[model samples]
Target: MPSYTCSTCEREFSHCASLQNHVKVHDNAVVDRALQKISEER
Candidate 1:
């Protein structure tokens, strides 16, 4: 079977839905980092 891989972390998932859900963690991390940076710049 083919695998769904996360481009950011290179993690592998067996299903597309699982890969999509996993990607949200990375997305949230990015948002968190941006917020932290903005606060630091203030």
Candidate 2:
């Protein structure tokens, strides 16, 4: 079986769909941090 890996966090998943879903968590975290930074700048 092939493994899928997350580029940002280097986490591994057995299925492509699982890896894709995991990537969204990273995306959300990035957006959250951006919002926090913007709020702090004000």
Candidate 3:
């Protein structure tokens, strides 16, 4: 799994999919957006 760092929540996730679900907490829009952006690029 790849390492993903979410600055919005200051937590690291093992993968982008996990990070996407985690962003639901604290409504971390930045992290969610980052994940989406990365996904779109890929």
Candidate 4:
């Protein structure tokens, strides 16, 4: 079986779909943090 690895955190997933979803979670968190910072600076 093949495995997928996350580039940002070095986490491993057994399935590609799981890895994709996990990455999206990280991406969303990043976006949320950026939005918060912009709001604070305004």
Predicted structure with the largest TM-score when compared to the true one: 2
RMSD of each: 0.6, 0.5, 10.9, 0.8
- Clashing residue pairs in all predictions, respectively, total 0, 0, 0, 0
After superposition on all CA atoms, how large is the RMSD of candidate 2? 0.5
Among all windows of ten consecutive residues in candidate 4, which has the lowest summed lDDT?
A: 20-29
Model 4 alpha-carbon miss at residue 5, Å: 0.3
Q: Candidate 3, residues 1-42: lDDT per residue as tens digits?
A: 579877676899988988788877757666788899999999
Q: Is candidate 2 or candidate 4 better by TM-score?
A: 2
TM-score of each: 0.92, 0.95, 0.50, 0.86
Say what the RMSD of model 3 is. 10.9
Model 4 scores what on Cα lDDT?
0.96
When summed lDDT is taken over every stretch of 10 residues in candidate 1, the lowest stretch is 1-10
Q: What is the lDDT of residue 21 in candidate 3?
A: 84
Those runs of model 4 whose alpha carbons end farther than 4 Å from true positions after fitting are none
> Which predicted model would earn the best lDDT?
1
The sequence of per-residue lDDT tens digits that candidate 4 reaches over residues 1-42 is 999999999999999999999999899999999999999999
* Whole-model lDDT values for every prediction: 0.98, 0.97, 0.81, 0.96
